[model samples]
Target: MQNDIIKCGLTEQTDSQFVDSIEKEAYVWYEKNWKHDDYEHSHHRSQLTFVEEGYQYFHIDQKIYLVPQNHIIWIPSGKLHKITSEAQTVNLMVFLFKSVFKDDFYRDLQVFAVSAVLKEMLLYASKWSQSVTEDEEQDIFFKAILKSLPNFCKESNFLEIPVPKDERLIPVCHYINVNFKYNLDIDSLAEKGKMSVRSLQRIFKNETGITLQKYHQLIRILKSIELIDTKQYTLSQIAYLVGYQSLSAFTSSYFSIMKSKPKINKK
Candidate 1:
């Protein structure tokens, strides 16, 4: 076990024990730069992961969620999850809540956008060391974050892509992810799966709960979000890079999923 791992309040074991056994009601881990290679585990405490810089890929329940900067990920207690650190360095902060109030936020894994206020609060909370025991002042502060946490989840839910369990569509999913930059018509995609268009669509929808076309668009939009953060490409260039022919078409699709105009974050 590396000293940094222990310093960050994470048990050396990837698969954390799920017993009723958290020492405190709440605690925090910050300045966590250690990388876990597809660390799949679940524990008794609900966890919140925030990135101070860079993004990470979190695989939860056979789905892939990308947590970019200004976003947060919530993993409910006992939900099996894996964190795949990207090749780039990621500054991650994780908080565990052993005792939580009854709320829908803690029931499922989600990656959502948060307001600047909430981000600042979390950054401030990171000042406490992981070794710090339960204290009244710290407990009250965590309670306040928990109370306002729900309000911070004010974004749409199109950020994640469900991993298809069907053996037939597994290769198909991989193809789409790698070839998203090119124009992907249904006919070719169906051919790639070695099935008829109708059968492919049915299985794709059944496994992912999203239509083939919609899933394709969702991938493009997710890619565009990453491009947007780079501050290097214009909207038109990003749209073109992500397989869209025109800016308006890309904007329409992004707005439909995100429920807002594309606003570039200057920070």
Candidate 2:
């Protein structure tokens, strides 16, 4: 218990100096079929996590992100989040104290692409001992990494899966998740939630940071990606399978969300 506490940046007090004070640190875990089910919590520092082997699910601020392998997940300081995984995974979590960043530090959850160079750097950082040595070479190395973070972020729309905190919206979100293939609209969702269209619109937009219609589209897009991975569904088939009646419309929406056209491989 004490070891876990100290590793997680919690500390006890001592006479002259505080025990377990950390500036920057990293911890890596390799697990087979690992799963964590913890309530939402916050940290005093920002965190960058690399999913090396399998995917991870992060619930933050009533939104869920499916961070797949070889991706990076950034949770800014004080943001409430919880993580869970159901597959064999290797996760490297690097915690950077707020003091390390000078200004314009990220304040929200961000999932972005990780470059090969950045991946190597994170791997090396994770190998550092608990008691990091204060050396000039280490200082230069960490400084370079801090300066490179913003550039590492992929300039693309992330999958912010809706998980509303409002009790009224929970059932609505679930319905949309399961029935994304159906033609869903604000009115349908409003009716399902027993609220006026305008009221539902306001609440959904406020809680999810997206309109009801757009959120539905995002759900379909995420589902389409999963289907695409099977290598069985043609682009047109996937389009209709995820609720897009028109092939052209589905292609446009897929391209808009994925920033690329859907590829159908011929086997």
Candidate 3:
């Protein structure tokens, strides 16, 4: 049965608010549930998700990302993806439309390693949510959070997953990067890696803190984002190119993993 606790769609703004002298609307939500569910597709808005507590996973194409505390996920506009989390997960999510920030400054989604100052900013924003009167202060805090994002062009090893030094999983990992668009499963991947499925599962989790399927999903989603960002393809076309047959199916799966849709820039 499909999980229904987590709802998906565009976030609504009850009122227009400006942050950091930037006139952009925002949506903040706090949820507790067994899982977060959403459809796969692209959107016109960029998003930032902060995981304060509990375990969550993001499937970006074929690579599975383990989201724990003190980490943020940035989803650029028009990138199709989805997100799921275990029960009792608390998150601070920020959404921004393209028209809000300056072109050069806020052109993409960036995952920033949380800093002490940024943490405090999130705390303040949460508190401010209880009182609408703190608009100015809230705006300041939100702007600071946006400014803290690591620019996409900036090279930072911190933004990457730590591929364990395990020699066994190396081939599996390499194969994933090379063949993410192909239909693959743990059993096939294990055979390709020359290991038993159970052994591969245990080793992968032990090394990457995520299962083999999840790892592949993350890589696939990330690659999908890259294609959307670099090439000109319709959402439907992208879905098939990435191994999804039905556009609706692809969109649903994508949203379930990326938490936001792929951003497509107009030519």
Per-residue lDDT tens digits for candidate 1, residues 201-249, read 9999999999877777778877887778677788999989999889898
Q: Which pairs clash (backbone N, Cα, C closer than 3 Å) in model 1? A: none
lDDT of 2 by residue, 8-75 (tens): 44442332111345544433333334445344556566667777655677887667787765678877
Q: After superposition, how far is residue 225 of candidate 2 from its true place, in Å?
A: 3.9
The C-alpha local distance difference test score for the whole of candidate 3 amounts to: 0.58
TM-score of each: 0.84, 0.70, 0.46
Error of 3 at 262 (Å): 33
lDDT tens digits, residues 38-98, model 3?
A: 4443455566677775445666654445554556777766566656554243454443434
Candidate number of the best TM-score: 1
Candidate 3 Cα deviation (angstroms), residue 118? 0.4
Q: Which residue runs of candidate 3 sit more than 4 Å off their true CA positions?
A: 1-24, 86-100, 103-105, 128-134, 151-267
* Cα shift from native, residue 212, model 1 (Å): 1.1
Candidate 2 vs 3: which has more TM-score? 2
What are the candidates' C-alpha RMSDs? 3.2, 5.5, 16.9
Model 1 spans > 4 angstroms off: 1-7, 14-22, 32-36, 85-89, 129-131, 229-232, 260-267
